[model samples]
Target: MQVTLKNFTKTFDDTTVIDSMNLAVNDGEMLALLGPSGCGKSTTLFAICGIHRINGGQILFGDRDVSDVPSQKRNVGVVFQNYALYPHLTVFENIAFPLSVRGDSKPDIEREVRAIAALTHIEELLARRPAQLSGGQQQRVALARALVRKPDVLLLDEPLANLDAKLRLEMRSEIRRIQLETGITAILVTHDQVEAMSMCDRIAIMNKGEILQIATPTDMYRAPVNKFVAGFLGNPPIVMLEGRTSGDGRFLVKEGTSLPLPARLAGMPGDTPLSLGVRPEHFGAAGANRVEGTISFVEPQGRETLFDVTLDDGVVLRSIQPARDDVVFGQKVVWPLDAEKLLAFDVSGRAV
Candidate 1:
């Protein structure tokens, strides 16, 4: 199913939660709404599922208008964050609850529940109650229940948030596999960048009730439209160095630090304030642009280590590289910055 929102607006009392937003989720494609808390990710999901009445705009499921449809009549399935399950009901009974509510026959419900259980790899846990299963197992039961009805659109509300780190990694692949095998249109709402980047086909980055940018993970990472988009997508976050354009075709970092400006950015009006954004991986040992700094902070990340290098003028650049005993904290070292990979933003935070 293809889901679309045109001028999708929502309000709570007087404040608008979703401002005249427009987005199209392709047919059978998984899209994620990623942002910080209270960014309207959940509000948008509920509106699409008919749980919240929008203050304005329209929502369509393919060619049908579902804006006025009731929650139960939309034929959409939602797997919530907490994996809402009945403690008293057995796994089989929980999976069959939705079917039972619709008054389906005993045989029909049995076949559907068993088939979904097998798909979710939970057939063995059918006789057990929610309290008897692990977090991952309970999650599978929730997914099974949602899929048993063969819903047109499957909504996942941070479905992996309750699990441990290992389980979250395990279920990421599991959910992706099940979604592909079933070919159902899925919308995932998450604040975790790793979850959104790894699990979905495309991500719509939301902030303060507006869609900032929507693109594939690679595209968004390579070229963000603004400072916020560039800074929001990466882990450890993209480092933004404040600077200004100089007359000698260079960028002057605050207080006596300078870098040669690429020809493309050399003519952007003298003294124009600029921000240079560089991802952690882009700072390395060899490149055309170099800066000398001291390793001030060290964070060991298994095979790779994160180091904060405080350069001349006190500019700090975070670099992630292979584990090395050669570089110790407070030691001076010169690192290179990939000129072509650097991101430039103007005063308004718009990409230059």
Candidate 2:
């Protein structure tokens, strides 16, 4: 189903949860609503599911307006954080519960349940109860249950939150595969930037009941609309340094280290204060542009090393190297900062 949220708003005793939020999920595409807790990501999902009443605006499913529809009638499949499975019920029964509720026949339910179980690769565990299965297996059962209904929309509320790191990675791929294979429009609510970036076609970054930016993961990462979005989306996070334009129209980072402003940015109004941002991975020793700093810390991650450098002006920046080095802490290094990889944000936090 193609879902649309137009000027949607929700309130709890005059405190608005979702304020004039507008977003659309194309048919068969997975849209991830990503943000930290109390940022209104889950509230938006609940508002769409009719669990929370809207104070204003419309929610549409295709051409129909379902803003006032009851939750039971929306034909939306929900997979909750806890898996919400019946302890006594076996996998087969759990997968068939939705069909049985709609009065599907036993033979038909069996066929549908088997199909979904096979699709989720849980066919062998059909006879096992919830307690007998691992967390990932239980998660698959929950997914199968939600899919058995063949609902118009699918809503996943942190469905993989309970799994371990390895399982979470595994399930992320599995969920993406299922979405592609079934061609079902899905809304995924997650706080994990990695999961959202890896699995969804587009991600909406939310904070304090508002969406900061919406774009494909690459755009959101490579070209964030503002400082908040830029700082919030990355893994080790983007390193930001206080910088300003010199009288000569050159961009000088900390310690009066002036670099010629890009020709394109020379048109910007004079006396603009800019914050320089650099991603850890973007720093390379091969680049001509170099920043002088002493290694404050080194974090080894097997395949890569994260080096935190304290510049001459007390600014700390992080850079990623291919692997751990013999360089000790407090060692001085001339790290290359790619000028093209640098991002600038104005005083208002908007990208410049």
Candidate 3:
């Protein structure tokens, strides 16, 4: 099933939350709605599942318009962040509950429940109640329950937020594998970039209740449509410094640093105010564009070290390198910038 929101609008009291948004989820693909808190991601999810009513426009399931359908009538299943489960019910009962509601025969219900239990690798856990099972097991039960109904669409809202680090990683792969095997069109609402990047086929970046951009993770990261999308997508983040094009074809940072302008920006007019951005990983040891800075901070991440490079003008930028002791705190060093990978944004925050 392909879910779509067309010119959808929603409001609360005097404020408009979602404003004339149009989006489509490809059939049998996992799509993620990624953004920071209060960005209307949850609101959009609720509107699709019918928890929140739309103020205008339409919601569609493939070619059929489901705009006026009630929540119960829509053939969609939701797996919530908390993994809503019945505490008193055993795993078998929990996974079987959905089919029971639809009046399936006892033999059919038992067969289906056991089948889903095997698929989720929770056959042994069928006898345990929610409280007796691990978080991962409970999650599987919730997923099995959602899938048992054979919903046209599956909605997951921060489904892995409750797990520990290792379990989260494990479940990310598990959910993605199950999604592929089932071929169900699913929507995931999450703020975690890794979860979105690792799990979804494409990501829809949202902010201020509007769909900013939608594309595969690689494309969105390599070529963000705007400054906000670029900044929001990376870990350790891209270092953005205010700069302007000098008549001599150089990017002059306001903090008294200058570098050769990228070849792609050669035709840009001089004195154009630009926001220069470079990822931490792009700063290296060999490039014509270089900056000398004192190491003010060194953070030892397992396999990589994140160094805070402070320039003479007191501006700080982060650089990532393999963990080594060649440079320490307060040591002066020169790091080259990969000018080709530097991104420039205009005053309006649009990429140049």
**C-alpha TM-score for every candidate:** 0.98, 0.96, 0.97
Task: Count the clashes in each prediction.
Answer: 0, 0, 0
- Put down candidate 3 lDDT per residue, 205-264, tens digits, no spaces: 999898889999999999998999999998889989998899677888897888777789
- Could you arrange the candidates by lDDT from highest to lowest? 1, 3, 2
- Candidate 1 — which residues are off by over 4 angstroms? none
Which candidate, 1 or 2, has the higher TM-score? 1
**Model 3 alpha-carbon drift over 4 Å, by segment:** none
Candidate 2: residue 167 lDDT (0-100): 99
Candidate 2 regions with alpha-carbon error over 4 angstroms: 247-249, 254-263
lDDT of 1 by residue, 1-352 (tens): 9999999999999988898999999988999999998999999999999889988999999999999999999999999999899888999999999999999999999999989999999989999999999999999999999899999999999999999999999999999999999999999999999999999999999999899999998998898899988989898899998989887778888867887776777777789899988789989645688788999999998898999998867888889888876899999998887777788999899999
Give residue 234's error in model 2 in angstroms.
Answer: 1.2
Report the CA-based lDDT of candidate 3 relative to the real structure: 0.91
lDDT of 2: 0.88
Q: List the residue pairs that clash in candidate 1.
A: none
Give one digit per residue, the lDDT tens place, for model 2 in 111-137.
Answer: 999999999999999999999999999
List the pairs of residues colliding in candidate 2: none
